[model samples]
Target chain A: MITFLFYLPFILGFVVIGVWGERKIASFIQDRYGPMEVGPKGLLQTIADLLKMLQKEDIRPKAADKPLFLMAPLLIFVAIFAGFAVLPISPAISGADIETGVFFLLAVVSLDVVGVLMAGWGSNNKYSLYGAMRSVAQIVSYEIPLGITVLCMVVIGSTLDLNELSSLQGIFTSETTYLFGIKSLGIDVTQIGGILSWNIVQVPFSFLIFLIFFIAGLAEANRAPFDLPESESELIGGYHTEYAGFRWGIFMLSEYAMMLLVSFLASILFFGGWNTPFPNIGSVTMATWTSGTPGELSGAIWGAFWLIFKTTIFVFVQMWVRWTYPRLRVDQLMSLSWKYLTPAALILLLLCGVWKMLMV
Target chain B: MDQMAVYLFYFFGLLAIAGALGILITRNLMHAAFLLIAVFLSVAAIFVLGGAEFVAVSQIMVYVGGILILLIFGIMLTNRISSDKIDTGFGNVLLGILVGCAFLVWVGDYILTQFNDQKAALEQTNNQTEKLGISLIADHVLAFELIAILLLIALIGAAYIAKKDKEEVME
Candidate 1:
C-alpha cells in the first residue's frame, strides 16, 4: 500500500514535468518563447490542460462502438503506465526493478499499438481504418529493426539488466577498447602506440547502428514526421478522429509517455543510463550529484539531474526532427523500414555478436 | 500478495482461453484478430508469472507486432470476404471445438505425465538471455539463416505482387 502510494506522485510528477520539458525543448530549438502564457513560464500548463480535459464533455459519436470506445482509452493509458512501471529513474528508484528491465519496458511500450488499432476499429470510419492499417504495417516493419538493434546492445552488454549495462559503461578505464582489438588502421595502436579508447571510438560501426536504431525508434514511436495515425491534414486526426475529451486525453498522454520512454532508452543504451558522462567522475568526485536523496529540492540533484539532462538532449533532438522534417508517405515509410533499416540492423547485430565472441 | 498474483493470473488465463476460443470459432476475421490480441496479452501475463520476461517481450513483439499486423493486412487485401459478414458454418464450429478440446486434453496429459515430475522440483528462474541466445546460435542456426533467406524472398515477392496489384487497382 505504501509503495503504491509512494510511486503515484512520482508518476504524476513525471507526466507533468514532461509537458514542461517539451515546452522548454520547443523554445530552445525554435528561438521563441513557448508556453509562457500558462503560469510561471508555463510550468502549470500541464495542470491547466488536465483541468480543461476534465471539464470538457466526453463525446462519442452515435456510430461509435460504445464498449470498445470506452475501453480503448483505458487500454492505451494502462499499457503506457505499465511501460513506465519498469523504467528505472535512479539507483534503487524503480517501480518494478525486475531483472529483465529492458524486456518489460519494450513489451509494455509496444502494446501501445494494439490500442491504436482498436481505436481505429471502434470508430468504424474510413480514414480511421486507413490510419490503423498504415499504423499496423509501419509498426510491423520498423519493429524488426528496433528489435535487432536492441539485440545488438544486449550482445554488447552481455546482460539485459539496464543497471548492469549502465554500470559497465561507468568503467572509465583509459585502456579499454571495443572487442579488445586495435584493428582500426591495422597498426594495433594500443599495443604499438598509445591512444584514447571509447566504445564510440573503438566500435564506430556499432555506434552507426545505434544512430540508425535511434531514427528507427523515432519512427517506431510514431512521433511527428512518422505520426501517420494522427496526420491531421491527411486523415483529420487519423485513427482518433472520433475521440474527444478524456479518451482523447488518454491517447495524447500515451504518446507523450512513449516519447519519454524512448528518450530514456536512448540514454540507457547510448548515453550510459544514469551514469555520468565523465567515467572517472561517476561516484567519487560527483558525490553531490550521485547521492540518492529524494526531493532534496537542491540546486543539484545528481542522479536525477544527469539522467534527465541526457534524456533532455535526446528529446530535444526528437522535437527538432519532428518540426524540421516532412512526414513520409505510407509506401515510403514501408520501403524505408524493409529496404534499408532492417537489413542494416541485422548486419550490425551479426558483426557485434561476432566481435564480442572473438573478443571473449 | 502471492495469492493475489495467482488469482490475477488465473483470471487473465481464463479470459485468454475464452478469447482464444472466440478467435478460433468466430467467422469475423477482424473480431478474431482482436480476440487473439487478448489471448496474446494473457499469455504474456503467464510469461511474467513464470519469470520469462524476455520471452514475454518477444511474444508481444513477434506475435502482436508481427503476426497480428500480417493478419490485418491479409484481411485488407483479400477480395472474397465482404466486410459486412463472414459466413462460418455451425458444423465447423462444433468440429473445431471438439478437436481443439481433444488436442488440449492430449497436451495436458503429456505435460502432466512427462514434465510434472521435474517441473515441481525446479524453481522459476531469471536471466534466460544466455540460454535462449545459445540455442538461437547453436541449435537454431539453420532456422535463423533460413529466416533471413525467407525474409529476402518475401521482400522481393511482396514488391512484385504489390506492384502488379497496384497497376490492376489503378487501372
Candidate 2:
C-alpha cells in the first residue's frame, strides 16, 4: 500500500534528479554553469530534456528483431523499477520490508543486463551489437567480484534483512573488549568493524575490493567509464544509438534508477545501511516497531522514518561519487577489473574467510 | 449474479488458454516466439489477479525480456530453410488438436472441482524474487555456483572458437 506510493515517488524522483545531476556534473567538470539558461540555475533542465525527447522520432531499423526491438525499453524500465519493492526509502515509506530483501534486490537488478543485450541485439547495427556484447562481458565479469564482496557482507551480517543490518547488532566497546582474553583501553575492534564487520574497514585490503566493486558497478550499470555502450563520441549514441522518444528516455532513466538502487544496496551492505554512526542520534522503542499491539511506534507505521533518513544519506553519497568520477577506457576498464579488482577481491575473500575461521 | 462473474472469468481464461494452444500449434518458429510472448504477458495479468505484483513484474521482465530475446536470437543465428517451415499434416493436426482438447478439458475440470474451488486458493504464490533468492542461496547454492562455472565455460568456449577463426584468417 504505502510501498506503491514510495515506489512511484522514488522512481520519479530518481529520474528527475538524475537529469539534473548529469547537467550539474557536466558544468562542474567544464568549469561553466550548464543549463543556467533553462531555469533557476538550470532546475528546469530535466523538464526541457524530457520535452525534447518526447518530440523526437521512434525509428526501428528494418533488419532488427521486431518484437525484441519494441521490448527493450519497457524491460529496462520494468527491471529498474522492480527493485523498489525492497528498498527502505522511509520509516513507513517502502513497499515490502521482506526478509530476503538484499537478495531480491540483486536478482531484479541483474535483469537490467537483459535490457542492455536486447538494445544491442535489436538495434541491428554493428556498433550497437559490439557495444552490447562488450557491455555484457564487462558487467558479467564485474558481477563476480561485486557479488563476492557482497557475499562477504552477507556472511558477517548473517540475516538478509536491510533494516536488521542497519541497526548494528555487532557494536562493541572497550569494557567489553576481548582479544585472546585481554581488554585494551583504547583499541576496540568492534568499533573498527562492528557486528557485521563491514568489509571495507575490517581489512585494509577490502578497500581495494570496494573501489573495484564500485567502479565495476558504475560500468555494469553503463554509467560512464563503461558507458561505451552509449558512446556518442565514437559510436554516435551506442547500443540504443538509433532509439528516440520515450524509449530512449526510459533507457536513460533506467540507468539512473539503477544507480540509485545499487547505491542503496552498497549502503546496506557496507556503510552500515541506516545505522547512525553515533548511537542514539535516533532510537525507537520496540513497541513502536511492533506498534499495533504495543507501547511504542515500532508497528506505528512511521517506524521507517529513521530507516529512510539513513538510506537517503547513503544514496546521496553515491550521487556524490557519480559526479566526481570521469569516464574509463574499454581496455583500461577490462584490465582494471580482471587484472586488478577481481584477483584482489578473490584474495581478500579467501584471507578474510580464513581469518574469520581462525578468530571463531 | 455470482455465476455471471464466474462466466466473465472464464471468458478471459478462454482467451489465455486458447492463445497458448495456438502457440503450440503454430508452424512458424518465429510465430511461436510471438505467441509465447502473448502467453507470458497474459500470465503476468494472471499473476496480478493472484495478488503477486512483484512476481508479475518479474515474469514480464524475465520471460518477455530475456527468454524471448534468446529464442528469437536462436532463430536468427540458425539458417532457417524450408525444412523449418514444414507443417504437420491434416490427420496429424486433427489428432494433436483432439489430444490438446482432451488435456484442456481434464485440466479445466480439475480447476473447477478438484482444487477445492476456493478464492483464497490462489495465494500460494511466493514473492517471486525472494523465493528465487532463497533457492539461490539455500537449496541450489551449488547450482547457483554452477551457473558461474557454466558462464565461465561458455566465455572460454566462445573465445576459443573466435580465436580459431582469427588464426584461419591470419593463415
Interface-residue RMSD per candidate?
3.0, 6.3
- lDDT for each residue of candidate 1 in A1-360, tens digit (9 for 90 to 100): 322554346556766777777777778778988888788888889899888888889888777666666777778778767766655555445446667777766766667677777787778777886777677667667777887888788777777777665544543223444333444444332321111232444455767777877877887778778988678898898778888877787777777766777787777776666555542232344433343343343422454666777877887788788877889888788888888988889889999988777653
Complex DockQ per candidate: 0.46, 0.10
- TM-scores of the candidates, chain A only: 0.82, 0.79
Candidate 1 residue runs with Cα over 4 Å from true position: A1-11, A14-17, A20-36, A94-99, A171-202, A279-301, A358-360, B1-9, B24-28, B51-53, B77-89, B97-105, B108-116, B139-160, B163-171
Compared with the true structure, the alpha-carbon lDDT of candidate 1 equals 0.70
Model 2: per-residue lDDT, tens digit, A1-360? 555676667667767866786677667866987778787888888888888888888877777767767888887778677777776543333346554566566656666666776677677777776677667667766766776776666655555666555443224212232222123323444533232243344433555656756776676677765676677777777778768788888888787777776667666566544333332212533322331321234422333443345446645555566567666777787778877877887776776666556543
Q: Return the TM-score for candidate 2, rounded to 2 decimals.
A: 0.67
Which residue pairs clash within candidate 1? A289-A302
Which regions of candidate 2 fall more than 4 Å away from where they truly are? A52-70, A90-99, A117-134, A137-141, A169-199, A202-205, A279-360, B1-171
State candidate 1's DockQ. Answer: 0.46
The whole-model lDDT of each prediction reads: 0.70, 0.62
TM-score (0 to 1) of chain B for each candidate = 0.74, 0.58
TM-scores of all models?
0.82, 0.67
